[model samples]
Target: MSTASIPKCPMCGKPRSAEHAPFCSTRCRDRDLVKWLDDGYAIPAEPVHPFADSERDDAV
Candidate 1:
């Protein structure tokens, strides 16, 4: 078995619990949630032009 198969807690670097597969405890889990809610995490995307929809319709 590869040790790489084992998952570590994202917050504290502890071995993950089955109950919390990615986070070691509820506290870590909640912290992650709060980060998302507070915009601590973000996904980058290309900006969409407001007239892009109109241009697509004209092409069709």
Candidate 2:
């Protein structure tokens, strides 16, 4: 496949490597891992009331 067809690294905007796949280098891959370990990324979820669990239990 042509390099132009391959997507750029999400971390560095450089060409992606076969070894790293989505990242340009091990450094970029590691940086992404660190970001995840440090809670730099988050998934959104619906907010729940603090007493929601208790309320449900009481209703049963």
- Which candidate's lDDT is highest? 2
Worst 10 residues of 1 by lDDT: 1-10
lDDT of 1 by residue, 1-60 (tens): 676787989998887888987898999999999999999997898998999999999999
Clashing pairs in 1: none
Per-prediction tally of clashes: 0, 0
Which ranges of candidate 2 are over 4 A from the true structure? 1-3
* Candidate 2: tens digits of C-alpha lDDT, residues 16-43: 9889989999999999999999999989
CA shift of 43, model 1, Å: 2.5
RMSD versus native structure for model 1: 3.5
Candidate 1, overall lDDT?
0.89
